[model samples]
Target: MAPAQSGAVLGLSLSLLLGACRIQAVKLSSDNLTPTVMEFQSVELSCIIKSTKTPNPRIEWKKIRNDETTYVYFDDEVTGAFENRADLLNRASLMIKNATRTDTATYRCEVVAKSDEKTIDEIKIVLTVQVKPVVPRCIVPKSVPVGSAAALYCDEKEGFPNPTYRWYWNSEPLPEESKSHPKYVNSSFKVDPKSGTLTFTSVVKADTGVYYCIATNQAGSAKCEGHSMEVYDLNIAAIVGGVIVVVLILALIIMGLCFAYRKGYFANSKPSTSYKTPAKPDCVNYLRTEDEGDFRHKSSFVI
Candidate 1:
């Protein structure tokens, strides 16, 4: 073979070798970029090695939540809250045996292969853990007067992705617009699903019924027990009669007090004069001696 041709062939071989090295550089990928699972259930975050030259590459996983980052896997071991419940699958993927709501966040998987031309590569995965809602706390008034205002409330705190509220009256769901539904046309109330408040602008006799509330989210729903609310009409005649009776009684009391004052029954009595006797002398005696020719003698003695 010619020397020039041999040199050209060697140069071509070197170029192909470099191209191969570039093609085999460390690379990472994921089968599922986003995975969702129910709370307490198991889930796997797929991190696959697309291409790499290193036989034993360094793998690490970090979780990003609320703009904060923390390690889930480091130093070839699971760490933090996932220490006991998580493990690596295929030496690259992460498997959580018991997922929780707090585990829902963005996760990053990184691989470092020093032997490869490109030393590092990474991929991101999003996890969502859905939590079922517990029974909600509900407050309903026991009684309300007709034409008066009333309010009912419901709330739940355990669900993931904050829950919305729904109210039921006598086992029937209440619509958001009362006038839109014939069954609820008699009620003058408003429902606030986000705040879980049911406000009655003006209650009537038809508003009396058994009420219950339900809280719902993407995971599940829960409801409180039913409570009865009574609405009664105001007895105007009876109330007026009672007021008149009270006023008459008060007036009679005032008249009795005035009559007692005018008759001198409550007047102050006249004060009587007081007399005091004079005190006698302590020890003094007077004696008359006729034998001494009308002589008077005075003596002082202690008794």
Candidate 2:
């Protein structure tokens, strides 16, 4: 009985060890990685080796970002498109030099040891790259008179790959027509992808609505809403505004008068509590003829 029990316990212990070996040592720092495109940018991917043992024999890095094809694997020492751009930073980390928008994808690390033959340990990491772009918003005088031109200035901030610019009037896109106006750049609207600045010339009343500044590059596209504009027609607007004010004032006065009359007559009046003496029935017949004549006269007065 003792020997049989010992064999069963040994079998159970081996099963548990096998389970541990099946588990991989590599673990990535994050799962969802997003990055933008640009030049001279560096992105780092990190992983942790779960095993206590050092001098990890075979550490491998691979790019598995695309759906169709798998990229470089460190074990093969063969870099596909990544080539020299991919580097294994020790056994626990990988770095991509000069990361561009195209280099963004899912990465994986695999660690293989001699202790467990034909058994492999592995993990996955994700890399994100972000390329900023030039965006513009309009800024100008607070108010403009009707039929007079308004000046609109646009300025762009930090962006990657030096985003290109496009101007929009309302939601409708604007064509690249070169015309001369007086605002910023010449009428054609100057755009410097490097500086990310867009300037508008003399803006007309037709341009007095919402404007959109669109920025795009190989990394991605982004847009921002510009300042709203309203070209005022002083004459017609002033007349309409005055009429609205007068109507509101008159309506308030009429409502106030009706409310005061109702409060005085209906709410403030008190009901009579004293009783009156009953009329004598003996006078009923005598007063009948008199009452009929009085009623006829009252009807004539009402008519």
Candidate 3:
């Protein structure tokens, strides 16, 4: 009885393993295998499924950008931003018309078959759209004072494969050597090829000229309109000297006033001692009698 029970248990385990190893309902693949194209061109990103149990499989396409997945093709129709420029046919193959750089992204082709329990097959394909360089915008200062820093800026934002830069003066390429030209003879000028920044530590009159910049990539090249740069003498030393002279004059005036105060030149005057007054001696009074009325004499005091 123990042997029979053990055999039944082994049979149940075998059934479970077989169920887990069932064959996939469908196999999905892309026709292009690896797709790459230039900007503003048509391309096909086709997906096909084989050996599907369901006659009609639900098809979908999704794109991934910046770690976010968004739907592009579904419900037997192209929807979202691609509705007007894309079409889905032949088991949900994607056909894009007039594709632009914005279309560059990773696309996933998904197919679902409904049988005894739904099954899905999906594959990912990356698309790249190359773009050429357009005319870059460049700015050169109208005027730069001598013995001061100067900067020239250039920008080219629309390009694929990235863009490189070159600068020109008077319609000629910039000199390779820093001191090779008269304008930059002082070794104060510098350039950055990647960021397109040209600088001068101490600009000079010789540095004045028409300047332009060019941007290039694998696809194409472009140039900006020529701009003018003028460098003039600032006479900054003379101005600074004048300021110092004025400050010294004011200092001298203040020092003179302080010295005068310390020497008592601003002290108060001393009191006077020149004059005196006389003193009175004494006062005497006499009473008048009736018999003496005829005599009628007034007494006076003398000092």
- Choose 1 or 3, whichever is better by lDDT: 1
Best prediction by lDDT:
1
The lDDT ranking, best first, is 1, 3, 2
RMSD of each: 6.6, 19.5, 13.9
Tens digits of per-residue lDDT for model 3, 147-257? 789889888999886788888989878864467778557647777888888888888777789999998887788999999988888787999999999999999999999
Please rank every candidate by TM-score, starting with the best: 1, 3, 2
Candidate lDDT values, in order: 0.91, 0.59, 0.82
> TM-score of every model?
0.80, 0.38, 0.59
Question: What TM-score does candidate 3 reach?
Answer: 0.59
lDDT of 2 by residue, 99-168 (tens): 7756667777776665544445666666656666544554545566665544455455555445676666
* Model 1 misplacement above 4 A: 1-24, 269-303
12, model 1: CA deviation in Å? 13
Model 3 error, position 198 (Å)? 1.7
In model 2, the number of clashes is 12
